[model samples]
Target chain A: MGKKTFIILAFQISLFNFFVTAQSLPEVKAHQKLMVEEEEKEEYEFARESKNEVEMVFSGLFLGYKKFISSQDGNTCVFTPSCSEYALMSIKKHGIILGTANAFDRLTRCNGLSPEKYRKDPESTLMIDKLE
Target chain B: MNIVKEKLSVFFILIFSLLGATKGHTQDLHQTFAFANELIESEQYERALLTFHRVLFFGKGSYQEEIFHQMGTCYYELQDFENAARYYDLAYFAEKNDSIKIELTFKKTSSLLLNKDYGYAQIELFNLPDNLNPYFSQKRNFYEGITYFGLGNFTESEKKFLRALPSGNAEEKEEIKQIFKNLEKVEKISPKKARILSMFIPGLGQVYAGDWRNGLNSFLLNAGFAVLAVQTAFQYSIWDVAISILPWYQRYHMGGYMGAERIAYEKIEREKGLIYSEILEVISETKTD
Candidate 1:
């Protein structure tokens, strides 16, 4: 082939290869159920302290649970977070007076509530195993 | 005889002191490992990996394999599967026991697969035996299926998943079932066909790929560019077509076709993920209950 034709052909081949590579994708592994993080351990251990307890409660009150739910799998929550975090957030955001009355139900809802694991260094609210 | 006795006593003293120092070294290493574990628990994963590396470098203890495994866990948690797989590979080779070797290999396979290092994952799958303990065997097949799926060999993936389903526990069974259900031979518009269709009529490929809004946008954008290019060529000069209109038209047209194929594959993958995750939720709930 002529030099110009060879150059054109090479460019086309490279472009096609780029598109093929882009189409073939990788899988994301789910975190193993008892995969403990240091942050969660710290949070759980410090949770017994009155200061940490109030901080967690205050965070939940500030729609932290809502943000947590949105971050994981985007619009998909298994009952674990759906039940616990949503209830907590709903109660805290909507009803200060009724939230106090509905404390028992609220506690029951988030029984298996798990905070999302971070891809890097970040605060974790509870030990996953403890939540489980 | 007295000279010989004195020499033997001096040698024994040296041996005992060496033993004592070795014991102390081991204890210090253990304490360091314990501290690293604490750091890991606090979510200081990067530091923990460094600490584990330090322990590996300074210590020549029996816990070498275990330390490599721990490093793998830290990297895996960070989603740095490349490093995780590397450490797991090291651990797999170092592990002497068959069961532990199998376990580390399994972890290595997953880390490789997740990192999109399919070549290594494939090699690990081949190295793995089907005659392992029932649990490992099932896990082995499942990871094999995952590797195949990553390579987009759907038929092999299906076959492996079928094998895994029979031997898997409740969770794997459900996972396999969802995969089977999602990959059920429903006809999807061929991405190649979509690309061809859109090559002729710019938005058709996106429409076929079920991206209706994009399809319409692509159609309008390409049609508008085509009109401008034609008008420019006829009314003023081919220079405008060459300089501006043609490039935009070609770029978007190519993008539209490629995007359609990409979206098609992504839609199927996304649906499968949803099915799997929803089942996982139920399983999690049942376990909790």
Candidate 2:
């Protein structure tokens, strides 16, 4: 009976030790209490921003130079004032702030900054590979 | 006397053993937290988030607030502002200490702002009781101003921002003033004018609004329809205009006019957003500084 009780106590200690060790493993995530470093921005995002810059410059000049002539038919165009008309007129009215803004909006029309689509996913660590 | 001493000695030994076990348990908890922190370090955010939550759910540890706050940070890192706001809110309410409440409230408010739940953030700012904590109050007011700016209530936003200016450090004050100046510079584009302009020329509205590419495209499309209607009428009959040209013309013409007003208004909104984002960047950078 004495031997059996001792064995039981030893087993319990072993189990407790195992539990502590398991808690410390890299895979066991519990309440993340630290900062995760940000990864570099995607290449395409940078490229798109650069292209937008170029468009902004050219569009400003193009709209600033000429006014559209009157057409014969009843408004053939769909957009009432149209994109070019808006750009030209807004620039003429509000200066480049409105003009540049209008051009930028048009450049990425209907595509709001889609955080859901662009959110960064966390990378798996190579520290301990659980190879199947 | 000896028997009594022996019993007392055994009781002390039992107490020590219990204390040792308790220490071991606490150490395990520490290791668990460390492991979770490591997950964050590894950039395994989703798993890290889950682990933090698990610690809250099962671990009867004392750092529940810390865990939830860490979860908030993880979501913030992911740029999932909605989730970050939710978790920050969780952390705010779960926090027991008054000292930490201010920090949590600030985090929750910012997260709400980033989530674009401007209305809620405004309310949360009000709830912070500006009368009590002057430091957080000033910061809160600045963010409140930003929220109003985001909502396009520029006047009210400017008022809130002005109130914050008198109290901030000189550099911060200068930053706020710059933002204020920029705020005044923001202009509204009238939708009515855009519609009227587009009425005469389909794509003219977009051109006037500064979208020359789409403007040109709109003109060409409608012009193509016009040409089709004229040519098809000459080729077949006026009835051919219906099948070939009128339908396409009508769609684009209507779209162009409506789109002009919509897109012009969208331009104003976009400009406001850009300015707001710039201000936010400056203020947020100042936070790190």
- Give the best candidate by TM-score: 2
lDDT, candidates in the order shown:
0.63, 0.62
Worst 10 residues of 2 chain B by lDDT: B280-289
lDDT by residue (B1-289, candidate 1, tens digit) is: 9999999999999999999999998888889899898988998999998888889888865677778888998998898999899899888878889888888887888778667787888998889776765455556666766667667676786676555543214554566566566656423547787778888887787788777876887787778888899999999899978997887677777777776776666656655445434433333332110
Candidate 1: residue pairs that collide: A38-B41, A38-B42, A38-B43, A39-B42, A39-B43, A84-A110
lDDT of 1 by residue, A16-64 (tens): 4222211111222252221111221113222223334544675544344
Look at candidate 2 and tell me the lDDT of residue B168: 30
Model 1 chain A, poorest ten-residue lDDT window?
A19-28
Residue B225 error for model 1, in Å?
Answer: 4.5
Model 2: runs farther than 4 Å from truth? A1-132, B1-26, B37-47, B166-187, B234-236, B281-289
Query: What's the true lDDT of residue B209 in model 2?
Result: 76
